[model samples]
Target: MSIFEEEILMLIQCTPRAGAQWPDFDTISEKDSHALAAAFQRASPFPHLVMDHLFPSPMLQAMAKEFDTAAPSDWREYHSGLQRKRGTPPGGHLPPTVQDYFNVVYSGPFVRLLSRITGIDDLIPDPALYGGGMHEVDAGGSFEIHMDFATHPRTRLVNRLALITYFNETWTSEDGGALELWELEPPRCAATVVPHFGRTVIMEQSARAAHGHPQPIREGRQRRSTVAYFYTNGLAARDANDTLATTYVPHAGYSRRQKAELYLRRFAPPMIVKGLKAINKAARTRHTRGRGSKL
Candidate 1:
């Protein structure tokens, strides 16, 4: 193993068993933080860190069981041309084990670890999980490449980071669900990550950070993962942006009119853009109500 992997394994082994189910605050030392921060900042294409077997195995196993046993009605479907997946409802509406997973990750210790590793401070977790939570994509499902929404719809805080953990116990290249990170300047694939169990990816969220699992899952397979976004009042000038919603990359199968609207939204005044979004949201709400389902 590489030195970085060795350090990560040591840190995981040193996690305290007493108290909460998550890693203890004292487990991450100053040296460890510095090392991790250096790795995160030096990542290519954009700042990101991927770690495997970093979390407690028992906890992840429990969370996987929750995903398997979740009722069909518990999922909120995202069914569109760009993506097809099912996500658990926000606002702590999760199974017991899954809720515990969120609780610890959103807690002070975990947030501090995230801040240390990313060199971004004052990170705040979303209690309502607006567009995040446990996500499952069955066979033939895919998500087109896109940058995440810039601003939180409810708190209005600027999104700065995303932490996603995979729960697929067995996955392979044939499964075709690797998460792809793209370069913005030339629009090329920069890196790919397989959604293996106990693997975690923490990415710096910015316009430059375009990612998705565009390839469809193989037959009889499912991709399972949990996502949590962190926010800050402000950050580096490069990461700052005014975009209010998710931005799809141009070549990701967007219609001509949809692409035109995206361009218009970018150049439009903030007030006008927000107004248009509000109208669109209201229409979607009405349509969802008519269909008796939540989107």
Candidate 2:
């Protein structure tokens, strides 16, 4: 057998399959959990954990294969300045393996394990998978640096954490889909996690947990991952005033005009900024109507 196949077999043999489909934290000993918790707390920029070979290779392979075969209609496209990608619609149909992966991770045992590792109790999973699922960014697509929404629109649960699992085999730095974790005060990237196959990243969500994959993918390459967010019933004091919606920030690489607009929104008087937004929305509406009339 090939080396890749051999490695997969070894992983399958070594990883314990308990009641859950994916790797379970219940298998981890108390000592290991303490070490993982330390690593998560000490991670720069935020409390987060990055694990390699997180899932059985065969499972990831199955998910990737199904994702490749999914019809275009299966995805909802995001085309804008801040983000350009595609995602499975919230509560929409998902490939069997991918759906199974979600079910396992969101299970009670898995969630309790997450709480043990992160020290956040009473975590809840979103069954509707709001703003998450299978995500794909094609060539020239990117998501700008931003903080995630603070509250679940439907459930009103305060967003607490995000878990992302990558499925891109043979990925490299040149592929340009690394997840960038940023320092908030100075606004610079603190760490970058490459989206290689079988890698999983779990991060605590707050105003300080700013991150994104802003660089566009290289031609002929597509970046793919599965995402799930966790929540709590109470909002943290630190994030009390964070925007209810996702908030995008200007990056160092952004043009002066873009940066100026960001500053205007941040420091401008509230009434003036609101008036500007109204004017911009009206203009867009008029332009859209004009196109429709021509069509």
Candidate 3:
């Protein structure tokens, strides 16, 4: 196990948000842990369980610093099919310390603790899904509410777990980049966790668990985070091997007019997309020849 995992095993336990106070989980006692877990058993902030502070404070701080310093990659320009980039692995080469930190945290105790808390302890993420690395989501960069890659290709396992660690130095509401969680019953928000420093959130991997960070950042500060997905080997869930949930193109982010356009595009025949691609390519070629460079 990695040292990061050792730190997590030494410091954390599961608890529900209802029974526990916010941002004060470090001091929550065992009694509160049980009560909170119970409260979430029937109903949680979302359809799934939400656990906080999966790693020790010191470890989290260390990881946060490393996460902030890792160079950002050029993944913004793509049909992420949603906001910003989809996901990017280690942006570039890292020093020994940074590499060691990722190795410890990504595959270490963080993953195990996640499994136990969710009662899917046997589950593991195909390293290929995340490449056993951290993912970065920046300011102006946001994601739609959707599930992750269904199964680990090599492992052929259904993804049943996922974890996120936010390292914002001083996240403020104006930052406009807090995670929004929605429940199906009311079909509305149940909780919005501010992306605070040393704050780690874990949740079950289910279609019902819809979540994403809406609105762009207003503050000058940037939003930073890392995520790891876990899976159960040889398991085929109903969603197994399906197109990533993000592909659905969540309509919640759209304005009224945007929503209509999206609906039209979503239900549009596949030939339309093919025709559009051809037209776009031809136009691009003409424009590029006119400018002597591709856009």
lDDT (0 to 1) per candidate: 0.80, 0.81, 0.53
Candidate number that wins on lDDT, 2 or 3: 2
93 Cα displacement, candidate 2 (Å): 0.9
Compute each candidate's TM-score over C-alphas.
Answer: 0.81, 0.82, 0.66
How good is model 2 by TM-score? 0.82
Ranking of all candidate structures by their lDDT, best first: 2, 1, 3
- Candidate 1 off by > 4 Å: 1-10, 235-240, 252-295
Residue pairs with backbone overlap in model 3? 5-109, 124-231, 125-231
Candidate 3, residue 207: how far the Cα is off, in Å: 1.7
Per residue, candidate 1 scores C-alpha lDDT tens digits across 1-295 of 1112211222553475587566675577788778778888988778898887667889999999989788877788776556778897767468888888888889898898898899888898998887888999999998878899898877878898999999997897689888888887767677888888898889999989999988899999999999999998753533647766777776655666556666766688878866876776678768978888643
Against the true structure, whose TM-score is highest?
2
Q: Residue 79's C-alpha lDDT in candidate 3? A: 29
What tens digits encode model 2's per-residue C-alpha lDDT throughout 1-295? 1111001111122246656446754676677677778888888878898887767788899999998888877898765556788999989999899999899789886798789889998889997899889999999889889989988888888898999999998998789978988887778887888888988888999878999998899999999999999999876633645455777766678866557666776788878866876786677669979999999
lDDT of 3 by residue, 29-102 (tens): 55554554444444454434444455446655676676556554522222233455334442445534435545
The clash numbers for all candidates, in the given order, read 0, 0, 3
